[model samples]
Target chain A: MATNSLPKADLTSSGRPVFLQNEIECSILSSVDLECDDIPNFPLLKSGLLVLTTHRLLWLPDNSSSSSSSSAAAVALPLSFLTHIFSTKKSVKTLFHSPRVRFQASLDSSKSVVMTVVMRGKGDTDAFLAKFWENWRARAWENDVQTQTQAGVGSSSVSGSGPGSGSGGFYTREGAVRMVGVSGILRKEQEMWESTDKSLQEAFQDLNALMSKAKEMVILAEKMRQKLLSGSNSKSSATNDDEVGSKEEMQDWLLSVGIVSPVTKESAGALYHQQLSRQLADYVRIPLERAGGMINLIDVYCLFNRARGTELISPDDLLRACSLWEKFDVPVMLRKFDSGVMVIQNKSHSDEEVFARIKALVTNPDTLRTGISASDAAMTLGIAPGMAKEHLLTAESKGLLCRDISPDGFRFYINLFPEINTDDVYLVKDYGIYNTWVRVASASRLE
Target chain B: MRRRPGIGGLQTAAAARDQYRLVGENVAKIRTDMMKEQLATFRTQLEEFARKHKNDIRKNPAFRSQFHEMCAKVGVDPLASNKGFWAELLGIGDFYYELGVQIVEICLATRPHNGGLINLQELCILLRQRKSDREAVSEDDCLRAISKLKVLGSGFEVISVGKKKLVRSVPTELNKDHNEILELAQAQGFVTVEEVERRFSWTSGRAIDALDTLLDEGLAMIDDGHRDGKRRYWFPCVSSNSTPVADT
Candidate 1:
């Protein structure tokens, strides 16, 4: 709690704290205060949000509840600093008082001090304390530190001892199970072979075992990704294209399962949807970017559930979470089209940008002849066909495009609705997209 | 390029002159016979094409529409007769006639509830309920069949009352104002003078004038029981009676 002792909390635009690499949020407690008994210049983190993560204990001023807390900077106390956690005391005095958690942490210059976390709100205080202890013992940060120092060669042997570590990487778990400290180079080769053998044997295991194994599976996947990344960076030409392709597929599958610390109903309780919405806003930035600033709600539902792995939320829950985004000042919105199809889009997503793309697509010489189908736009826009259809329809409604319903399929053309002189249907403009369309459409006739 | 004869009569006389001489008449007859033979061959080819893509024509609305376009180009109106060559080949003419007859049955049955003004989508739903799932019809198909019913002198026609398509079975000539009033009443089952004025961007006089006509024709009911004294025009024809009174 000493002044300038703890690292500053990096926050997302929506005021949620930015997690460290491979870090995940575990629990949240509101209206919490962090205080140190001995330190004089300790920052007064009074009645703020307390977030327990795999790597750090983050405390932020609850800007969502109290506007006054906006000026108070967010702070993080890495779990690495903690020396011991005190047990809860039971008494009549404790019942009348707010829940309190005490822990000793060595701050800057190894000066260990006693810090008390006072939970003033009616959050699940006991659950927060229990997660605090569990996270401290799990020591995910220590594993990360070990992985870096070892260059991940002996990663499979030691990190596999952690709870739920059996779902280790396909490379590491199969390769290094029986190997000790031989030559570091020889050990990796041995580990790879062992992993291959083990994977086949473990293929028929019960799902319950695999359920427990999933957590470590994520860690092992991360480790393998790190190794592959470093391998690519150092020896790009040496790695075979086949190897990189398989690695990429493995990474993608593993990355989908990367949201290790999903905000569960049991964890957030009454504030489940609100917290989920905030988390979702943070989660969608990368996906939104990938989808060109917007994605259908159905696609989002699948991606979110896939990312959460075993912690799958219901569609109703996902919808409620999306609906709660409106109440909060988030950077994403849930938009419902005229057709009742819903999508999650970036707040900055503009129809002009999409229309410009559609205009470009429809006005192309090839597209001018045949017109652009929804699937054609979907492929070009890197979006789902249904979503592309919505965009196309929106563009159509805006008169930026017009539809041609025919035997081939439903398609869109750059809107000639305005440029079209209905008084003379046969009159050609002699210029513009409409003129181009006419020329292209009649090219076959001329031939 | 000018001909010496008066253009219309000259062309007619030239046409007759060819038939006057025996050789000229015989040559003309052969040409006419050849054109007829080509038309017959074209008809047979079209029938084969229809037979080959029968399921496509039946299942895909867009495909069926394309086939219809082709038929139109060849002066072949498949829906013209029930027992014609096209009907024998595809039975599409029979299908539409059956659909039109069923639509007539539905319109009369539901006429009391909607005052002979039924929503097109609702009418199609009722039609589908009466028929099997194999015969899935679209709005365009319904429109086509309904147009054929006009020959019966029954005012079975589709009208756009707002975004909803309303099938008006009665021969009540609905002007734009009356149509607007009916459409306005569609949402809430009733509309006051103020509501109509706000909706159609009309003045109070225009709104009252339209509402008065509807009330006089008995197409709409007058509800002035409220304490506010605002005259509410409720079009029983378009209003399906689901909306509550307080919505106005």
Candidate 2:
């Protein structure tokens, strides 16, 4: 066995491939073998899940595969190497043979080979071939590569007055006559309404129409992001504070409109779940970072589906996907609390930090007086109430806090248990939290 | 020139040592006697304090309980014989004795209806009616009085089923199964045969049998008024608004 020098795809800690900018997964096929007839030392790449993206084609060893005999290492083939794709054969001879799609690709500029994509798995071979051509021609990554140079032009025109230009067309901001403050805002609002009105009209024309518009929608989102980025950079001094603020707000809204070529059941076939899991592992990194490194599984589901737009996954699928994270070396992980509450947290997220925060929240004078309910902690921590409860319970188990179950409902207070002198219940030490509590409690009793 | 330091000289020194030993013994005896004298004085002082606060000890439950704690630390049982200097001073012994007598009367009165098992709250209600504004009886006072009445027999005791205190006025001993049924009934103040079946994973027959025994013992009441037609075995012994019953 010779050392196979195929391009190694970098996998996320959770086992998802690190995607290039603007690259999106188009389709996936299981039990695939990427073989080049002319290249004999191409490594015995047998029966792995093949994923086609706008930028690259990736192959990962199937979980049930006996690839231990071969180099089961995942490999990526840049789509740029794909010189030509042969149309599928629909003859009776093709029916007798395994379904295959052939294309010309090169590992480098000098060596080219006819690559055969053997799809032993069951799926619409023609549909996969169609998407293969569609993404190849779309060339989404070529646009991302030119981003730095196009940035200046991208920005100036998107500032409400450029000549209806930038990013080759779809979802480009056409422009309004340059104005200041209120009028500019009104014009921005008018432009937003017209875009919505136009998209809605096109979306409802028919299902096929909506499906065709999907790519345009993704491109529009990308274009808006570019415009916003440029609007802030090149025209920061020119634009008023309010204008910049609106642009920033728009940037946030458009930021998550990705997963452009979401892996669908129809596209991914039997590999739907495996591909979806990897995609989810990729999608959750940003939101998980913002949510203090921990978020309820339900929140992740809602956010992931919202960002995905039309590619909504079931709760069962989300759970299975999250569970599969254990097998991969992804940066984020799924954590199930003792209370059966499931959450996603960054692998580097320390419970000690959360406990420290909870300790601070509980010991504050107002909190000491009234204590904190789960909802109150949620408001302070900026998380969902249910997730906050799980945190509170964790803190309680760690002995950082104690629960007070009363008619008012369950609340948590800083654990003053250690400070309390059980030998003499009436005695309050002159220093420490106990005396402070005693003073406040006694004073409050008079009121 | 002054002292022989060895053997027979040491024997003469032993006589002096004996005399010093005698003196130390005498001193120890006197110290012990002094301690006894101080203890006697302390007891007298405690009595005087009790006399000073006799009205407070009698009328105020908080003050009375505090006084009781002080007495307990000194190994004083004021109600031990009910006839003592301590009893005369605070009159706490008589208060408990009176409470006990009233409790006995109420338990006997409710025995026919509740099958010698009654809720503590209902017993308190009856006692208040019998002796209105007398000493302002509390559940704690009732519990203490009943604890004293336990001297009559093992049957006069308080048993808790869930949060409800039941005073069993009969001599029947409840086993674990009966106690568990009562404990389960505490949540909604009542349990049904179906609920018992579901909660304890008991067969319908087993649930009915246990509930029926409780019903027969007057520890529980039955309501057939439910729309679902399930017999709700209401254990007044474990119900929220019922009196604590005592066993015989």
Candidate 3:
């Protein structure tokens, strides 16, 4: 591990970065080499996917190979420790060689080492280098840690020095500002507004300027969301319901405006779908749980696109991404109904289980008499009617249920078809769905 | 005068008297022809009465029963009274409504549209005609007609109707419409005012009002609505096009 000087990362069970509460992904790269010549036993850690977040640089192994069978491990480098980055030397020798970046940092008091990042994959090396430089210089991690500590300070105070203050010696006298109490909070807000105004004015100056400020805008949105969350929690009783509702809506809007780390063609390149596939696997878990372990592909598309904010993926992309889940050890799988509608369902979600429940529901005297519509099933199943329809249809296909179309509406009944002997429809034998249905249906008809 | 000329002797005079009597008889025959016209008129009136009574025999149950008794008295067979014959005399109108219902069901199941499809108008017209008829359509007649229609034969499947009713067969084409409507309704917890408007291309408020009518009539149902100000309407399912409001 020491030999693999590449920073390590923590991944969720589904392979997504276990982002700090407010931390977000910024950019991604593939087939990168983080080499420290000073460390002898460092792991080679070659050709892995690198994700840059607000707080850390994360690396994950390429999953296309059998090596993925190795324990799901990731490496991360806390952006807080980054010191100086060396600019690329564009000599004839460097021009002929693979694009590389060199950075120097001290891991301990005893020594500091120069790390070389070799870009072996086909990507915009220049763009990556520029972003890398910007991220390093922006000191976003310091702000994140500061916010994190402020969050830890409870609802009472807002003053705290950022974690990277050790490097504050580099700040010019004009950059220094001492903040304390309510006045300090107001002054900070003022400074933030002036900075935002300056950036807005600069952004209007040119398209290139706006593009440069895009990351800053995302950061600003994140900060606003965090501030709102903390504010809402602290003043929980002070705000009225209407204001709270609007704030909640605003919070939702802000939360969905961007995915701090969108897997882009620029980052993952040829492996875009694979990485996107993994990210989707991680993303769908919540919605899947909410939907009771399954969801329509179209629904997932909508939710996933919503969660991704502006980076809306196409249906084709979503389909391809979902298809890739088969090769991975993901918990969700794609399912196609007999009706040809596709859905995403948890692997553990068994139709037999849903069928058993539906069987119970339809066999109930009330449901047996009224017959359950898709909505009724949806209500009982705690799912969308669309999803419930799929389940009901599946049950229908399995001959576990049958459909009734009448002047009233379409509904599903326990498959009295199987229970009713075609030879004698009126012959409702004891101890069968047919007999039960007849008893209920007859009573209703009589009524 | 000819008889007098023919008479030559006293005996001949007797023969002449007989000839004159014959001529007088011919004149009387002409008078009789004039007088017989009244009898012919009376006979014509009797014939009209018989014709009117024939119609009465078919329509008026009492007349029919009396006529049947008279026919029995007169040694003529009376028409049989039974369910089968009654159904036959009622013709196809009795089954038209049921057929129309099945057609709508098939169309709805086969191709789901937002609404306002040209085919839907045609189907609605057909259903309206079936519904307007005073006679209740029998399910069997509808099923029979559907079975006979070549185009619908493959696509339609018969579903047993309620007790005492004939089985209603739906066309597979309606499945498509059902699916589309279901999908649209599902996407919205309830069919939204916007969705109704979009589907029907009706005025905003009108679409919502119409949807409410559909809801109230039990043709559709509201499953859920958005918490946001916008109201969503969910349909339990599409209603049978030919079903009377009272049936629901």
TM-score for each model: 0.44, 0.42, 0.45
Using lDDT, give the best candidate's number.
Answer: 1
The best candidate by TM-score is: 3
Model 2 residue runs over 4 Å out of place are A1-6, A63-70, A87-97, A108-111, A137-151, A158-258, A326-333, A336-340, A347-447, B1-248
Taking the tens digit of each residue's C-alpha lDDT, what string does model 3 give over B161-181?
Answer: 222221212222112233344
Task: Compose the digit string of candidate 2's lDDT tens values, residues A163-200.
Answer: 22211222345474444443353454445545644764
Q: In order, how many clashes per candidate?
A: 7, 26, 35
Candidate 1 chain A, run of 10 with poorest lDDT: A161-170
Docking quality of model 3: it rates as incorrect
Each candidate's fnat = 0.00, 0.00, 0.03
Full-model lDDT for every candidate: 0.60, 0.59, 0.53
Writing each residue's lDDT as its tens digit, candidate 1 over B1-248 gives 24565788788777755544443333333323333343334334444444344443333222233344333333222222223467435544444554554565466556445545677888888766534323466776678767654433333467664566777653332124555565566678788988877876664444554566455544567778878998777654345522221210
Error of 3 at A154 (Å): 15
Give Cα distance to truth, residue B73, candidate 3, Å: 99
Candidate 1 chain B TM? Answer: 0.38
What value does DockQ give for candidate 1? 0.01
Q: What is the DockQ of each candidate?
A: 0.01, 0.00, 0.01
Q: How much is the lDDT of residue A25 in candidate 3? A: 59
